[model samples]
Target: MRYFALATDYDGTLAADGRVTKDTLTALKQLRASGRKLILVTGRELDDLLQVFEQIDLFDYVVAENGALLYCPASRQEKLLGEPAPTEFIKALRDRQVNPLSVGRVIVATWHPQETAVLETIRDLGLELQVIFNKGAVMVLPSGINKAAGLAAALDEMKLSPHNVVGVGDAENDHAFLSVCECSVAVANALPMLKERVDFVTDSSRGDGVIELIDKLIASDLSELDEQLQRHNILLGTKKDNSEVNIQPSGSSILLAGTSGGGKSTLATAVLERIAEQKYQFCIIDPEGDYENFEGAVVLGDAERSPRLTEVLDLLEKPYENVVVNLLGIAVEDRPAFFAELLPALLELRSRTGRPHWIVVDEAHHLMPASWNPASLTLPQQLEGMMLITVHPDRVAAAGLSLINTIVTVGNSPQENIKAFCEALGDCPPQIAPQTLETGEALAWFRGKQTEPFCFRIAPGHRERRRHARKYAEGELGEDKSFYFQGSQGKLNLRAQNLILFIQIAEGVDDETWLYHLQRGDYSRWFRQAIKDESLAEEAEEIEQNNRTSAHESRDAIKGAIAQHYTLPA
Candidate 1:
């Protein structure tokens, strides 16, 4: 978390004799420019407060009268947080011939020889207040109320927590605020009690101390952030040939090819369960809709009806513990084009917000066939944590395998898939078959140049994990017919995995020509049945119209047109 607010005491903490130094004001201005909220929590009354710092809008908010009042400098608005002091409390002190100075929400006086009698009078009033001594000044405030409460209320308005707040003070009254902030700094000239409770004690007193703290904070934040990297198992290092190569956990993608009841889905579910335990967000493209019930999952598309693209996009934008996109019920012919439109938007979002720890695309061949153009779409340079599961490894595009960091094989009779893998992986040797694999057992290859694959059996999911299981359903037609249509669509869209099945199928068989047609938005021949609802169909038609018009318009003009489309009335 980053610091977003600073609450400092005004008198002894930031200035001397209620006078702010020129350097202190300059430092405060710099922090304000960076968008940090500055709050002054003090016991001074409104009039005396403005008199001390007459410059308007110098602070974002002020906590006047200790914790009893809140003031917004920008709007010049004042709100009282608690009840006023009892008239009897002040009148009794005066009855004893002891003059009490009423300052804002606080009352102060000198430590007199008859202090015990004065203390008894205060007790009799039945008011909750504390006496804070700072040199010769004795301050009294409401019970359970102090500078800390003032700062807390200010921070709450800005949606900032104590973990992201910093406070600086030098007197005993300021102790409450200092203890709650993430970082509290005490000036050299501060009281001994305040110094002992803070994190860092600044060497410079007054305004100079304020400048030193900000400089250190900015320096530490930038450096510390760079050291935290996204966690992934795939390793990348130099090969024996002194060439730079990747050692993926398995390979670019893992195709779980096997007959029905072969435990492929079970094995994949186990891996997903383990990854979720690590707390990394992952999205499972469940064609069968079996993984929706898992914890932290954001299910999309289903056995009941496939989800619209826009709905999935909305869920993706919100932070999720785990996201499972179930595309199981969509027609087989639509999966490729569905992915085509969906992948690009996902990639664009990933570029903006850093990629998910893993993008588990189940039934890979349905969305990405063997001849699809991988170059046209932006690929995550570091594909250390991507999992693609499929029963038809031969149907998955070979070009997509080049970026695989790992390959996990979960069933038997993988001779054809192995041949396809060797051919797609560039220079790779064939491997002897593994005789047998249990329900969760798999042959894991972690890198491109490795000689042997690691074999391990995955664990089972807990009973609690059943709620988030994926929604599974068969496609429009059989697998073979759908694969042919997807392969013939020129080049499938690799940008959006969800919209690949909806892309306009372009004519021509050549890979280059197919890729060109797909990129050019030649979607006249394709339509997705999954988005047949009235509102969704209209939106889809609008998108097609926009894509068609984009071909003849200038880029800037197109942007202006889009802006016009989304513009709202004043």
Candidate 2:
């Protein structure tokens, strides 16, 4: 169920001449029976809409008064989404002879040709309200109030996301709400502008068009239009010829394969950042706590504790929260079993909510080994969007590899990785020139492209993502990447393998020794190259160059800089 709800405009959309057809009603019922929700978004006032339409209860929610009011059909509850129409404003409109005027709890509406008078009265009164036009109807409501606002309020109350909604509309006023839905439809009778802008315009007009839409949703979830919604496709990178490479957020499976220190996490970070920016939820099955400090997501477990399955699921149910399931506390061999149990629950949740939109399985080989079979359910069919990253694709389960539709290889062995993946799938691999990918570059093969894989510059992330923050902060770094202090005469030979050790050693080293390294720009260089923290390095560079500051002052300043970004030991 990609689209979990249908939000339809009332006038000239779901209803023709303010009446819904029996066939449309039957279609709506059948859609609801499919376990999807329905919402009515209309510019008509609640009282008028209720009196004119007998099938009010057909919708779970009614976003009326053009987004100024929210009503729950089941509870018979009405909530004002915006402040009520001001008494003075209404009185002024009456005085101005804005004829055929009507007022709702929060809307003041009149037929146009009086819109000039409405605008003049608003200016004369110096009111902070906006006028919206729906064909011949002129409506006045608070600024930012519209069908979209109302629908958002209704969706919030329903615990649903706009990405899970499919909206249909007919006229100018429908643009706001329709634009926000994952899929927008316009009836055949819809205005030319609306029809041009919508994802699809129905062949049939009015309520019949709605039935056509509902039938399509129930039958296929509108899968035929998957490629048509290019607005939702995430940009992966640009190709060799400078053409874009995009991954559709829905029904996509990507394999990001590379060796350690190959910048796979860096590439993955950029993708996740894009997902978060779009407000889609993702669950990262972090086998190594690499994402514990990831931005815009709640880190479920840490180095010392593994979060319970129920806790992770409970947080994910919100449809807005992202979760990082850190497996640091879970033993290495037991990770596959934990993920085996977790995958089904996650798939079940997505089946119902269409969320945790992307599931990222890091270190795929270790977590879902080739020996671990998921035969009970077909992963390639059940899973929608996922990114599986591993050093060895052959080590990952064949079932898991089957889910991949696009293969993005990072690091030195790009061709080998793709060839190995193709062998694992028992398919012929595409040919490519034998070469090494430069730093921050990747070779991507999108299935069915009819061409060999091409190299592209990997897009960078905004944040200096401390990918594997725990490793840089606490774990041992190889001697090559570690910072060593044997300053001046080499009286004291101390190696700071990680950040915590660096800070402790800095505090104990003599002032002259500290000054020696600080003067040499060693701190900034080590931070940028070893820790992979560019911002922290810039800050350290600033502090290191200031000769007026004492060694102790620089130490505190540097320590504070690290603490500002990375969490330091208390």
lDDT of each: 0.59, 0.90
| Lowest-sum lDDT 10-residue window in model 2 | 374-383
Q: Best candidate, TM-score-wise?
A: 2
Deviation of model 1 at 218, angstroms? 4.5
> For residues 171-205, what per-residue lDDT tens digits would candidate 2 score against the true structure?
99999999999999999999999999999999999
Candidate that would win on lDDT: 2
Superposed Cα RMSD, model 1: 23.4
| Tens digit per residue, CA lDDT, model 1, 369-470 | 876775336354445356777777667776556666556565675444556666665646456564676555555564555456545544445432232111
> Against the true structure, candidate 1 has what lDDT?
0.59
TM-score of each: 0.45, 0.81
